[model samples]
Target: MNSYIRVSLAVLLVALAPVHSLFHPGVNTITPDAPKLRSLGAQQGILRSVAGSQNLKSQDSLRLKGGVTSILKSLKDALFPVETWEMPKFFSMSAMMFMIIYIYTTVRDTKDTLVVSTCGAESITFLKVYGVLPAATMFMLYYSRISNIFSKKALFYVTALPFMAFYAVFAYFIYPNREILHPPIPQDLDERWKYAVSLLSNWSYSLFYVVSELWGSVGVSVLFWQLANDIIPVWQANRFYPLFGQLANIAPICAGQTVAYFAHLSDKGDDAFGVALQQTTVLILAAGACFMLLYHYICVLGERD
Candidate 1:
């Protein structure tokens, strides 16, 4: 029965993956018209408020009050605060994790959009097999090596700083000069050469996709949780872990909406890609910095106490 319960919990966690994926398609399709959607929602809300004020029957009002009450009750249960000084720590850690996960999902979704736009379906299939699997293998090997050399706190920097630098360089240099770096296709190339060229042409996008894939493993699955476990006591974890898990489940929704909002603000012309990349780069850096600062602060507090 204990083993069965463990398997059931694991399955429940795996099921949440689809919830995050559902946010991606909306970002890809609706981003172009995000402003219009927001406006429409606002108009509907206003109309509903006006109608309610003018002609709300007692039955309708009762139903509305019941719905609102139920929503408030659910919110209270989901976000119930701990009665301790560690409440700030719990909230800060939760917020930091949420930001890290949000950055990962948003960037991953954006990278997917670029990959599909630049390469296509077959390229995605090739990336899943040839690109990501090999990168994952190499990363694990390197990570294992460094685990012996560096403390866990230092290991976080060893992994994260390089990624941040690469992103900065890619956003500022490679992406903007992509066309210059990879010129138009020549008519004289052989068929096999042409296929190779097609894949090589999207080199930066492919690299972005690979790095984004690794971010989840390095940032969220490893570093963030490791830090959490190091700080939060087991008894406190029993109370806050479920709330943190719930916050994590809500993060992808917030991330998707943020991506859509930014995409809506993006320029309509050739500068759109650059603008989007720059914006996401800022967000990625900010999330990493904030997470590290909070991690350090929490550790200091833990040590002092």
Candidate 2:
């Protein structure tokens, strides 16, 4: 009976010893599942990243991780002189240029068409000499004086806002009411100097042509550059300007198509020009507003970066 009890105790000890080893392993014991746990954690991190911030705006700058895609992206960044975070800034500047050029094209085309169709082509030469020269001179003086008194941002608003507002007002009120606004002239007024007189008679169109010219010279050439230079450093601007120019070139094409489409809207009847003018003005105002917005955003980015 004693031998049987001792043998049963020995068997219990052997079985329990292995169970104790599992709960309290040796110092040098390696976890069998450690590698798999690490791999699963890594996979989950990647999945979380993929599910979150899909737009990549929140993504960390890609490290040069020796992958093919990473290497290509790095090269692209180098060539463009831009980081992932800088894309919005870049695109905003480009879009601003686009809007500027679009407004210019739309206004200029319509100006020329109005001049040639109503006042004769020769009147353009006269207006360029008399109207544009005087207006530009005054504007240059005004710009020079205001530059001293106002901040660049304020100056931009002063210079640009008036043009946009006047354009809107002209489209809605001035041009449409030109016949009533103009002076009564002889039906048989066929003098060579009659072209200039006719332009003077249709004074709204003359004013429109002059404003359009000043817009090209001042609003576009001066204001746009001022805004661009304010946001981007010269070193970085060189890389961006060429691309901006190329992208902005599309605006002219779009303007042409817009004009054509509206001009051909025979359903508008005799009011086609009026409808086109109003629609184009809306676009110009929208573009001007957006350009200012982008300028503000880029300025914010510049401050932050």
Candidate 3:
């Protein structure tokens, strides 16, 4: 067999392995050891002491004033640092990361909701077999090949521009034609083939799920972290990483609200799925572009140093 064919089969097997494990019940299950309550209590006490120490530090700082002003000052100091060159990079990267996480969450939710609604539960298993697994393997391969050929900065554009174009095309043309692309299933199919045929019939939605899953791996995990580590210095990272992590936690709350608001708008429409897809596609593409631009600026800054 050709090397490509072998790789393709490997990808399929790897995808199917998870589903196989899920079916075999106790084959994978192991009895849990008894909980170590004494050890757990000790760890909880240690955590409480550490948190108490941090709270004391904040209290010390806030005690300078006696009223609400003291509380406000402490909160402000905790969130925002004294301004420095690194501060802008920190804020920009945090904002970009927020957009990336928000868009990924929104798109993934939209795709999964659409798939389950349109094709049902078994379609999810079929999609893993036919869609996500292949896309993930091919993405890794593409990233590997490109990392060897392109500079980190160039690689961002190489990967991102194509995806932006894909989303754009999907939003403007392909998504609108989703119903046409996924035609009604034939009544004559063999019983064995019917389930598979039903899934294949909803190809457009499956493809959406595949692409949305890739955004987390390729767009956020690979591209964003690579750029962050490249720019952020080791010494500063200890202090700044925690702050940015807090910002990351807050991002999901904001993203959830944003998604809910759009979902509300979608509910008002006659074609809710179509409206949601259109809204999410535009948001994903816009976020992707902004992330690329921010990354380009970071690259430029790195070169200047």
Candidate 4:
């Protein structure tokens, strides 16, 4: 049926061609509609050209649209690179990881400022062996006991809140009172005993250093990774982890800018370290809180699924 229809249409078009040309006016021949026919052909040509340009324009638009789509898909693959269903958990977990590392960098920097500025650089080596080691051991025992008692979510706060509180007080209170809090050691004391005395003298700074170190070791290495291992499936853990790890570089850039800005603003003053410590402490607390919120959100997402 379709073949017959095509043959009939072809025959009709062929038969009409001569009939249509019979109305044409040649250069020597004159007709009432010669001008009209010439004008009509010209108009037809104009219409044909306009339609062809319009087709080209539409094709160009489609090509541009496809290019934009391809670029967007590439960005999505680079950034998230997770399945559509995985996006919620992936985004939440990755953001939380970024926030954790950001705050940790700020805290570690601040801790160094507190210890080295007050007790000198040599004090750090002594403080870690004498100070951080014992504290880590005690924290390990406490963590074991609490692990049995508190829920995982509650344990996060239990572990983090003290670190956060110490950060607040050390910067605002203890650091300001270092003269009274840290005692003076005699000039002639033995080298080995001198650092021990300094560690004892500047107990607050030592404690700050210890807590900050543990926060890095325990708060992140143990708490966060453990949670991540549980929440993310082993099959997919390979996918989005690296993306967020690189994303963490963003934190250091912002942190470096903040430190430089504070240093610049306070360079002339005797309180240069003081100013940087306070600013970074504020940033650490803020990032820590954001991380807590993000963790809770990710946990909720996990439960929902």
TM-score of every candidate: 0.69, 0.73, 0.69, 0.74
Candidate 4's residue-wise lDDT over 1-305, tens digit each?
99999999988977876666677535323246778878999999999999999999999999999999999999987766788898888777777777777777777776787678767898888888878899889999999999999998999889888888988998899888878877787788887687788778778877877887898787668767888888888778878667767777887777777777887888887877777788878888888898889888888988997
As for candidate 3, its clashing pairs are none
* Selected candidate, larger TM-score, 1 vs 4: 4
**In model 1, what are the clashing residue pairs, if there are any?**
none
2 or 4, greater by lDDT: 2
| Per-residue error (Å), model 3, residue 57 | 27
> Lowest summed-lDDT stretch of 10 residues in model 1?
23-32
Query: Could you report the Cα RMSD, in angstroms, for every candidate shown?
Result: 34.2, 11.1, 37.7, 10.7
Off by over 4 Å in 1: 1-81, 183-197
Tens-place lDDT per residue, model 1, 1-305, is 99999999988867865675586655433246777888999999999998887676766889999999999887875678475677778888888788788878887887898888877756777787778899999999999999999997788889788778878888889889898886665668785555455556778888888988988888887878888888888888887888888888777998788777777779695798788778877887887788778877777777865
Model 4 spans > 4 angstroms off:
1-75, 78-80, 83-88, 267-272
Model 3, residue 237: C-alpha shift (Å): 1.8
TM-score of 4: 0.74
Comparing 2 with 3 on lDDT, the higher-scoring candidate is 2
